[model samples]
Target: MTADISTPSRALDTDSTLPADAAAPASVTFADLGLPATILRAVTDLGFTIPSAIQEKAIPALVSGRDITGVAQTGTGKTAAFGLPMLAALDPSLRRVQALVLTPTRELAMQVAEAIETFAAHVDGLQVVAVYGGSPYQPQQRALRAGAQVVVGTPGRVMDHLERGSLVLDDIRYLVLDEADEMLRMGFAEDVEKIFGQAPTKRQVALFSATMPPQIRRVAAQHLNDPVEIAVTRQSSTVTSVRQTYAVVPFRHKTGALARILATSDADAAIVFTRTRGAAEEVGSALVERGVSAATISGDVAQKDREKIVERLRSGALDVLVATDVAARGLDVDRIGLVVNFDLPGEPEAYVHRIGRTGRAGRTGEAMSFVTPQERGRLRSIERTIRATLEEVEIPSPADVSAHKVRSLLTQVAARQEAGRLSMYQGLVREYVTEHGIDPIELAAALAALAVGDDGPRAREEQERFEAEREQARAARRTADVRGPRREGDRPERSRGVRRDAAGTRYRLSVGHTHGAQPGGIVGALTNEAGLNGSDVGKIDIFPSFSLVDILAPLDADAMDRISRARVAGKPLRIKLDEGAPVSRARTARPTGDRPRGAHGPAGRHDERRTERREWAPRDGAERKPRHRTA
Candidate 1:
């Protein structure tokens, strides 16, 4: 795949020039884009008075049955750009997957489907259903059987239904690939190609992506017929309204640092991006423990409930939303005054999307990224893409946090005064002063403490206690790791083969069982430092003082050095390529009988009996392993 990616237009500043085809009158509305009355009415009802540049140009092309390749960033109303035209062009009477929209994540698929439903709300007898991997099959299957006109789904799950004869596309009139580049990044290129093959040849294709990578351009050139290439990314890479800043936060103290940062920032609400679903939960819980009202949305969360969480975020009921990028798709909230990169995005384009969640309505929003000492390059890449240097900021001091808290308390007091209330509290304060026999000045100080939530102890003291304990724990683990391989309890289901993609390369990493390294930690490090998805990481074998991991390809010296600096289980990875054969033999396998359940003993004390590795030959033309059923 050579770099077939078409160059995007000039800078995206407000005054920047746009593509020749994208020119439109500032007064143009969605109704002026030749959409049918039903969709136009829906647009009006949805408060879409004007058309986005992409929507303006794309709706017309797609309505006329010409292919379109929309190149735009996230939060540019791309969903509406494709959905309006697809809805307007669909013949609702002939219902058998008339239009199929493919998104990268289940959350995005649900978002697109919901928008499609909203756009087609007035269209009579039209049915829409979103199908993805996480949810049960029965509901999606039922929707299809009930004559759904439009089906939106992720690629792998869509492929599943297609293979099972559940989602027939024979009558498919329109095929839309949303976030095509994201799908590729998630390793769904093959599945998307298969889907392209399955869809009807005589169909309109509308493809949109934030980037035009080589693979995407290749796919577009191969599948699209004289496509209208609309590029809307001719503006400043990062928004001018977003004051970008970063802090050098150590990974161990990250949670505490996050608490302090959030406390001191003037943000009304914020979104903290994490690397994985598990990490999202962890960070969210940590924030809650630190007295922040936080919630988490990830692939683990049900589609039905994500709306409520995001609504809370928008309503300012939730102060912080800890989320992974996949789960936070289409999460628009105007009140968000901050965006925190708890974990840097795995891709540069994702960085833009994360920050774009805020600074909406031409309002200034602050974005803060927590960069580890090892992740400077990731920071640099983001700066290169955003075309602006992020201001390096220092972590908030304890005094700063305390001052912010005092300010917040004073603001609350002022609001109460403005409300002209609190007589009940005043009466109580008088009663307390009389009952306790305290001086008026002392009584006033006590009341102030109560208002400021001074729980008769110092907040700094507690934070220091927590930090000291964590440091001690880290030290203890480092000391224990040097002794020998510690017996791993609560281990994952022992599988023989370390699974890797076909093109994956094997690497050996120091600090394995002895260092308390687990597959989860390795996955975390790779996602953070190597910019690789969990799926891109292959088989992992835990050995004494070392481990073997399978990755997509051999990393160059710089990447390998970055991995070496990355920590897993509080130990530096110190990675090196494993030129030796992949550890596929059965001797490397640990069977059930090797150790008693819940057993924990020193390395040399355990028995070394192991299961022989056996060749996994396909039986009677059966598949050795099937493609994963999620895109």
Candidate 2:
């Protein structure tokens, strides 16, 4: 494949009248780019049917073995744009390094190496080595000595190898500088130049950058000869489908607050971003402590561990991931529904990139930021950069968290019921109740409360504190909203309630573990469908076969109708009561047929006498009901 390296279009305005290069005609496929059959087969296996814009334009130029300069965004699949052709152009028979790709950070280098390996999987006998700082270099040196055809490394370590004369690029035929602009920003321009000087002048050179700065272009002119230039434009300032939200969380409570938020969010998979590698580990550990399956990725993580973590995230083995900016580079997970910023991003560009992890490939996503009072200015800066306002969300209250958990439990129960495995549990329940002389309702309530961690004092205290803080935050936000810019018709709409019930109606749903239902999903579905805020929802009881949700009584008939028809986890909820009847009747019904045959015969006289005796029993009474026997 050859790039159309036409002469420059116009001369410089100055005396240096250098003609600008003409753009090349767009190619459509990897086949058009002349990729080897082996690489094409690998692409097909990877499920990439057609070439991306970068791939179509860059592959041809790269395969032609010409010096190329590409300007593209991070998520445009630039790694493969150069990687495929480089692998195809490799001389597998040769023992020495034939290609060298330098990245600004170790994470990017590892990513490039992994990508190259994936593309070259079918190309037998291809050895690709990734070398970076902060680890033993002997292993890398050994791999190089044994024969590595391609070397992907960070500039600092690559320079170290060059200085030590451990790496020989004299035989190198291709050189790639990925994220060229970032390398320059990191003060690696001098090192890049020095490294480029070491490679053969006649070698094929490729420089890929997200942005075209004067410095990057100068490097291109100095190193690349008659290079083919390709620029890929961003589709939009912000991904339209991503729901951007932020919370003003204090720095000290940010980690705890993030855990709570994640606990309450309807996220399948999430990425938590931190400014530093250490913070990634810290936040990841915190989440793990809170019983979330989590992993950390950063520039410092071993290549093997990073790959494993990425694999886990992709396979849904891990639900939450904490990563630094550089560590998350080249990650392309389709199931990542949420991206969180534990620390406010220092640059608006970084924020864009962080949030861009979600809302990928036309899929809807969410990006949430935790901003401290001091970082309010930073939040404004981010808003200005994205040219949009981020909706301020109140931190979820303890009640909200509890409700989410209950819904999750109920969803799990529904799933279990759908699986038709409730007979075993039913048997266990009957036997337990018979042996203990316990009321089934009381036993079920205890079990449900236990499952959702609804212990007495601690749970109440936590809920109270969370509610207080949430109310304070909401008040602050309402005040700010009143003062901030408002649309012409931004007045609050009057809400009408049809009735007010002293006690809410308890409606059941057909969702549980069998349906892969989570508490957050149920809450989200109800909140969205009912148009009632999370706060309006009450107690949630998750049984093995189903889940029960509390709705305000004097309920909006229209809302209830909508909820009954609504689909949760693709299943329409019966939305009635435990007895499979309307909520109104169930609320007033008394339990029948279930009375102990013992001391309380058919009549309720013995039970009433026992209750009276127990109530009259003094603290000093010698005979007392055993703690476990007082049903």
Report the CA-based lDDT of candidate 1 relative to the real structure: 0.68
- Residues 387-424, model 1: lDDT tens digits: 78999877775656766777777778777898987899
Weakest ten-residue segment in model 2 by summed lDDT: 11-20
In the range 24-119, model 2's lDDT, one tens digit per residue, is 323354556798899987665443445556777788888877778888755456778888889988889899999999876655565567667767
lDDT of 2: 0.67
Model 1, C-alpha of 64: deviation from truth (Å): 0.7
Model 2 residue 275 CA deviation (Å) reads 11
Q: For model 1, give the RMSD to the true fold.
A: 13.6
Q: Which stretches of candidate 1 lie over 4 Å from their true place?
A: 1-27, 71-77, 92-95, 104-111, 114-118, 121-128, 134-139, 179-189, 209-222, 232-234, 237-242, 246-365, 369-381, 391-403, 407-446, 457-631
The worst-scoring run of ten residues by lDDT in candidate 1 lies at: 1-10
